[model samples]
Target chain A: MIVSLTHLDTPAALIDVPRMQRNIQRMQQRMDNLGVRLRPHIKTSKCLPTVRAQIDAGAQGVTVSTLKEAEHCFAAGIRDIFYAVAMAPGKLPQALALLREGCQLSILTDSLAGAQAIVDFGQQHDTNFDVWVEIDCDGHRSGLKEDDKALVQIARLLTRGGSSLCGVMTHAGSSYELDNQPALQALAEQERRVCVSAAQRIREAGLVCPQVSIGSTPTALSAQNLDGVTEVRAGVYVFFDLVMHNVGVCRRDELALSVLTTIIGHQPDKGWIITDAGWMAMSRDRGTQRQHRDYGYGQVCTEHGDWLEDLRFGAANQEHGIITLQNPASLDIVVRFPVGSRLRILPNHACATGAQFPHYHACEATGEVHIWSRLHGW
Target chain B: MIVSLTHLDTPAALIDVPRMQRNIQRMQQRMDNLGVRLRPHIKTSKCLPTVRAQIDAGAQGVTVSTLKEAEHCFAAGIRDIFYAVAMAPGKLPQALALLREGCQLSILTDSLAGAQAIVDFGQQHDTNFDVWVEIDCDGHRSGLKEDDKALVQIARLLTRGGSSLCGVMTHAGSSYELDNQPALQALAEQERRVCVSAAQRIREAGLVCPQVSIGSTPTALSAQNLDGVTEVRAGVYVFFDLVMHNVGVCRRDELALSVLTTIIGHQPDKGWIITDAGWMAMSRDRGTQRQHRDYGYGQVCTEHGDWLEDLRFGAANQEHGIITLQNPASLDIVVRFPVGSRLRILPNHACATGAQFPHYHACEATGEVHIWSRLHGW
Candidate 1:
């Protein structure tokens, strides 16, 4: 019980501090070499200490997914916060309050209507806002096409309506699907090109688009250069998971986040070792299922962080995980993983898995554990 | 400014209180007709008001998934709480604390080693626990086989060790895979028979196996008769989801839980309307993917609670949901779902999606809303 994770409750989120620092250093150094500020997305951890570590590692201000997150980061003294998702008109008051409080906040939008609402609300509140237009480099989830005519229209709307145009940003989230370096690097370049091109189009309309931001954990690490980009905003790199591991960006050993679980029961005949960590702990993010290597629910590891390649986390209930052998030959699973034995599971998505916990058990290299509270709920 | 769901923040969990009460009434009446106690599993809502509604509707005890949930329910004056997962030795101390504090907490185990540990811990603490043996009915997740030889061994171990063997319980979690009424009814009967058989096996060994508990949302709702069962425990039935709907247990209109989101941006070319609610709000539970009808992520509905059958929630990032048309045709999505317009997304799995929020905006029949806080994390 001397500060080790062994005594903590099962299905607890464990953050290997050394691995986390190393991952952060690696991402920050890469961005530095590429001459771009790393505005680390705090949406991944939602933990102030982790975000502080990123800041200490030469990363710039944080990027948030929700205005609630923006408020939390700002309260933590992080002034340069960027709300990366398109601003919904209903949340304008929340953003206005954050900006009025002296937080250097930037909101995003990809549509003319969204931009108009933001500009209109800012004017109504008599507070000018720094707004970034979202661009879609990859045909993924959100954002407008890089070459869309709406790019200049939105930029003109923001700048003309007394809001500061803070350039363009895009996340090639599709990079998570690629496992090859060449393809990832190409996507990263495409992300950079698309974002810079959007900024170029905005600037051509006589509006000054100052910064061009682009990233995703895979793209940021695989990018050859940031010739036109000014800053990179990447989450998940702070706590790489099996999804990133499958994407060929980080090693399994570098996955800083894992769910510490205990063997509770077993179905020996079925070659199964039932664990207390479930999809609720690892999240329902079967991110690697479509990747090169599908880590069923998660990659199973020993209590000391050693991977158990022979076993796979195949199924999970709300609070029970099913760990079975890949080959299913007799290995005396009951004896090998008896009741009360501890194991760690590398998650499919760090953000999704981390959200399942209220706080993380930060395990230092010295085996000393500390509880770092997380900001949950919007 | 009215107390309506439309005024709440986007990506909020909404519970139709009237529908919830109706669902509760329906389940309670079904259990009454079947001659069994209704030990409502509180794992789905984890909300005090919701649980109180269940108790108000004649639910005898509450079933929880974690000790944290037990603590919450106990603090809220719920005494008969059952932690249904196979007990881990590591959690014995936490369970002991709850028991010592006068929580009528019933713990579970299916393994001999687990039973031994629980008995030993109870003895060491100078306290006796009411323990229930878990029986595997449908080979779903966790539990011992109904006829496993270990059943007698575990029962004898607990009874002789001074711990009270309360009963045997089983959950036909695999019933979720069946979409037809006949298969679900068959599985329900099997679930009841297996659990009753396990108790009989223990009783034949001259032990008093006083209770037989069995359920799952689908099984409990579809069970023709629970002849030998003392009580039935079902969680998701309180807020039926699309998974339950596809499982032929509940209808889409009966789904009491939903995520209220606001349209933020659009990819009109791709027939996408990006909403603020994503996997973070809805959870990544694709429970209906392999069911009879695959709801991509969720079924999109109008803010007024009318289902938009043409639209499907296809993909999601952390906070971005991509709502696309099932048949990719131009419906002028941007105009139809204009920015700032509200939308409701019916989740695939109620338990998984409900866990994503801190509280629910419970809307009553009068369009009035109240905040019902939830229990989060262990």
Candidate 2:
């Protein structure tokens, strides 16, 4: 059944279908031009319909952060899956199960112990697991440094353990901090060079490392060349948020995801219009706090999707959002935003905000909404 | 079935049932002493078992932030409930349905327009909603200030529209900012005074306002006198978190909710033990950031629930947490927290963290885990 924006339940996760499709097309076209497979990270949406849209727009396999997502995507008929996080030792059995069920599920490892566990599990199960060595292009988070000797050590251990050393992957996650084109492009280049070098070093050590995967939403969109990279994995670009907007990757108008809420009450004297979309709906991801712009909780928009330049959702509790006006000089908030009026709030981090809801109200061009169920939990 | 913490799934939400019961007993005892009914806000834990525990421990009814919560709780045989958020015009039908289904559900309204909507909906549906006027005790979020003329106007409108003017309710949400007893006690007094005054004003205007409700976790625990207040509602006190720890309400040992995570990898040079419990499991609630102590993402504890004083979850990504050693002088993170080792992380906000999971692994004194399903979304 088709539902309009007005009919949607308050505090609903609304995916502007046209904007989402445009975002998908933009990222897919960029990857196509760079001659690299675009393994769109389904972690951002976790909704099958959203993943299907990405695949329809020329995306290759899906990149997942959790085993649950891999299983969900596999159940939705997408066989090629990559569990991107460093594989936990106990989670090996789950990964093996996915592979046994005809899923091209690739697991990641950055340490010898991780690789050895995979090796042990592979040998015990008589299954050669497809494993990728995670390389750290930037010292942002977890991964074996590209120049570290452990890269080849892990690769060798995987092969010795009867597991297939598929490739080396890296995420220049710090690219999210860069707001300029040059900085983003440089990080993208560095991410490409380092990850490719890791793949080369692994191959030089008598290991077959075929794929060199690298990306982050910012790096994927900014890279001028992929060079030796086989595939790019990026999330959040599929539903551009305030963080991506401040990172100079996408315009605010390009953001596809928003929380549809109703103005429940008002503190007229404080010039605050309270809404039902609190941190629970918008998420506590203050991703834009240190960015070029700090959208406290989110940027408020009209029910029609027009930006409310003067209004910003500054503070949020469990179930109440305190939306205050920037210029409160002459504004009578209670008169301007009467109770029961609906509003759309664009979140700071699309990934975090999208995770708050169980499903997305996919809004089409004709104002119709389709409920897209999301995969939750591990 | 009995399960040790180490044997349970990694990145799971675990509720320390014993500690929760103690927390419940403490709050219920205090409310009993104050001569007021305890309507525990089930928003903190939308799990039926958790709410059942509260009800079992002398809680009269439940306070819900969303209609979905009210519906979920009502289905579990909890008939009396307070839909705390100001009524949205569209949700009147849902409330009416719950009311028709024999739920003694109470709705809140803070504005003349909001009250009018309830009145209009009540008249249109031929249902009289037990409406409560929300008074703003502190300049925190939503509510009409206690002295505001709109309070009486809203109540009058509710009475004239064939709705029962139940009472006035206020939450001293700003009490969260107070860490000292003096400030908390004073704020608690303020919350009680303002809410009672609003109730009196409504009565002086020839309307029946029997219920005078007020609270917040801090205020509910600190209030010395109830005076004219009929009931107190508070959430988060059930499973105290790091925020409550810093609020001087609960000791670190008293925290009942902790994310059970497994150390997946290590950044030895950076003194970081990477864990599977990311912000996705612990949530991005930095509620303690502005408190007396900033516990980064969360405070680390041993698998047995003992505080790991030297460790703290400093940062988190989608599926990875960077647990750093506070004293890295002689600490070998890789050796101390070996890969695959399990740990428990007490959350900054129990309400936020618990919402991330589909169910809580309720851990009893014997280390047995019982899956308690959680209600998600509106």
Give residue A299's lDDT in candidate 1 (0 to 100): 88
The residue pairs that clash in candidate 1, if any, are none
- lDDT accuracy of residue A291 in candidate 2: 89
C-alpha DockQ of every model: 0.84, 0.82
lDDT of 1 by residue, A159-276 (tens): 8899999889999999888989999989998999888888888777788989999989999999998898999999999999888888888987789999999999998888888999
Q: Kindly report which residue pairs in candidate 2 clash with one another.
A: none
Q: What range of 10 consecutive residues in model 1 chain B has the weakest lDDT sum? A: B1-10
Please provide, for model 2 over B2-101, each residue's C-alpha lDDT reduced to its tens digit, 9 standing for 90 to 100: 5665557678999989999999999999999999999999999999999999999999999999999999988889999999999999888899999999
Q: List residue ranges in candidate 2 displaced over 4 A.
A: B1-4
- List fnat per candidate, in order: 0.83, 0.75
Q: Which 10-residue window in model 1 chain A sums to the lowest lDDT?
A: A1-10
For model 1 the local lDDT of residue B311 reads 92
TM-score of chain B, per candidate?
0.97, 0.98
Tens digits of per-residue lDDT, candidate 1, B32-78, equal: 99899999999999999999999999999999999999999999899
